[model samples]
Target chain A: MKFLCGIALIALPAFTFYCWLLLDSETFLSLLQESIPIQTQYIGLSNRLLALVPGLIPIALLMRGAWHLRRLFGLFAVRAFFHEEIAQRLHGFAFMLVFSVLAKPVAGALSSAALTMNYPEGERSISVTIESGDLTTLFIGVIFLIIAWVLREAHQLSKENAEIV
Target chain B: MSILVNLDAMLAKRKKRSRELAEYVGITEQNISLLRTGRVRGIRFSTLDKICEFLECQPGDLLEYKSNVDLTQ
Candidate 1:
């Protein structure tokens, strides 16, 4: 379990850096076009950098979620299954997931606007999208929130049981 | 907080060490110590039963209800 978490912790930032900086512009634009349904002309370096500004919101949220998940896994690796902090970290991760989902459309619109900002005035566009995948993520986040609540209840029960004999 | 553990007194009357009671009760000596000091929240019925059987005492002899005692103090 810890091994998997370690791999994920290492992979997350590497993957993010690759996607954000290392990937070629044409490939990145093609991927963006697939997700955002926006027409792209020749995207300048300035516009790509500008798009990263709005993109930072969801990225930050996801990174925060990963941080909490790592902590939760650390506790689990030590067999602290009912530790109070387990529920707290899980709650934090779940909260981040929900907020990240909520922030996605806003970030997408701003990023779209940023990407197209170099276009002629009438052609510049901001597109807000809510896909089925976003809904699925929202649902999973809500389910995780409920699981966190349940874990808190279980932790309380464990605490009370520990007080006995 | 109102319920006081009289385990130490019971152990003295029974001529049994906390270690002996802990062994008979299948619990740790630390838990036995906790029970003796009245520092525990509660005791399980099975543990209480084992202690009672080992010490030849009733539950009432091992526990006392003291009214108007401030636990926080």
Candidate 2:
């Protein structure tokens, strides 16, 4: 599982960045068009890229947090899960998950606004989706945060108990 | 942290080295050092009994309480 997470920690961002490049670069726009069909025409490259910034930032942060989580799990595989470092990493993962879940709607709005910014006055399509998955992700993030808190308390008690020998 | 250990004074009065006491108690010298410095949170009853037996003294002879409040008041 740790090894798989390590692979994902590296691969997810690489794929997201590749998608970003395909979307942002004119040179790769043809590839993007060929791979994914979209009716909306992109306008004002700078503004579009700028708008995409909000979305990309969260994705990057999410990837970074997952990477940290993977490392923490790796430590756990070596029986280091009872340490404060594990608790810290769990907290970090929980926070990043929360941020990612909350930022999704904002990213969706930014993308929709960016794509339709310069479209014909009456023909622009702005789409906002509220997915059930988003709610599930938010709930999972909250659960992870609660688990982190419990782990923190457990680690503290373990430390105190170890000292009592 | 509030429990003061007088293991060192007892050892000195018994003319016993910490290492010797630790060997007799079947514990490590490092733990003996911890006890002498009052750094350990608590000692096991078996270990304390062993130490007391080895030192020829009661537990009270090797342990003291330093209260934060003034009990006299």
Candidate 3:
């Protein structure tokens, strides 16, 4: 699990950079166009790349959350589930995920604004898209925070129990 | 904070070492030291019973309560 997260952490930035390159470099654009059907009207390279930033912001947050999640899993793998650090890492991951989920609308707005920035004033359009499925990810993040709180209480009890002897 | 463990005095009066008491009670000497120094949170009934039996003393002889007083002094 840790290995997979590490690989993903590395892969996301690389993939984002590749996409950025595709927006500018004809070579990567041709490669992507060959494999994927390009249905959208082609916008200016700078506008497309700028629009991509807001979407990439959420991915970056996810990468950070995944790093902490990986650490939590690593602790569990070593049977350190009761350690105080586990609760901290779990909470951090949860908050990051929650923030990422909540920022989705803002990201959409930013992406739209970036895309339409240079268009003639009357012609500019502001677009925002929402997908209902993202709520499930928000709920999962909340659940992680709840579990972390429970673990914190358990950790305190464990400490008291240890001192009993 | 007023509750105190008198295990050290009990062990002294019984002319027993903490190590011997720990062995007789089936616990580690480090725990015996903790109990003697009043550093532990609490003791298990089984462990308390063993200590009482091994020391040939009542539980009261091993623990006492005093009014809370200024600890800084």
Candidate 4:
């Protein structure tokens, strides 16, 4: 449990930094051009920075998820298995993941629009993309949410059992 | 609340302390205290068996059902 907490502590910042770096990289622009129906050549530095604005939505959600995961691990490390906070943190992380997945298409559309904002007025486009990865994330998030609910039920049972002689 | 615990009376009749019964029953003194005061939700069958065996009494001697008792209280 301590090891997992340590890993989560490291992963939180690592993932956040990785996402920021990825969003700012040239590779991301090329990938965006391939996935989004937009002219990557017309995307200047200002447009690229503008495009990063939409990416922040998922990044923020993921960061919050990571924070909740770290806290949950911290509770486990202290042997607080049946604590209400454990279920709450798991629920928070799960919902953050679910919201991040849901925000993907909206962010993608906004990013595409931001990227094409500098283009000729008639040439600008707004495109929404949904990949298989988003569906997978949503599925996992729902599973975690169910687990959190079960954990809460288990906590209640534990409390009741503790009151018994 | 209708199911009343008479553990205190049984323990007194048996001339045994709560600490001694707690040790023999493999439970905490705090739990014994709760049982004696009728503050517990319920007693496990194994624990009840241990207590009855230690006190040489039946389950009925340690518990009673009172229909007129105010459950909420």
Best candidate according to TM-score: 1
Interface RMSD, all candidates in order, equals: 0.7, 1.6, 0.8, 0.5
Model 1 scores a TM of 0.86
**What is the full ranking by TM-score, best candidate first?**
1, 3, 4, 2
Model 3 C-alpha RMSD vs. true structure (Å) is: 4.0
Better of 1 and 2 by lDDT: 1
Q: Scoring only chain A, what TM-score does candidate 3 earn? A: 0.82
State which candidate, 2 or 3, has the greater TM-score. 3
Share of native interface contacts present in candidate 2: 0.65
Error of 2 at A123 (Å): 4.5
List, residue by residue over A1-165, the lDDT tens digit for candidate 2: 678877877887777666655455564445434422224544466655655676576687688778778878888899975668888888888889888877776776666566666677775555555578878988998998999899999988887776654
DockQ of each: 0.80, 0.55, 0.83, 0.82
Give the per-residue lDDT digits (tens) of candidate 1, residues A1-165. 546655665776667657656678778877787556687656777887788778778777877888889889889888987789998999998999999999989999998998898898888889999989889999999999999999999988888888889
The models' CA-based lDDT, in order, is 0.84, 0.74, 0.80, 0.82
DockQ of the two-chain complex in candidate 1: 0.80
Ranking by lDDT: 1, 4, 3, 2
User: Tens digit of lDDT per residue, candidate 3, span B1-73?
Assistant: 7788999888889999999988998989999888888888889999999999999999899889876764444
Clashing pairs in 1: none
- lDDT by residue (tens digit), candidate 3, A1-165: 888888988998888777754545455445434322232344577876787888687888889998998898899889986789999999989988998888776776776677667877775655555556678889999999999899889999999999987
Q: Cα lDDT for residue A142, model 3?
A: 99
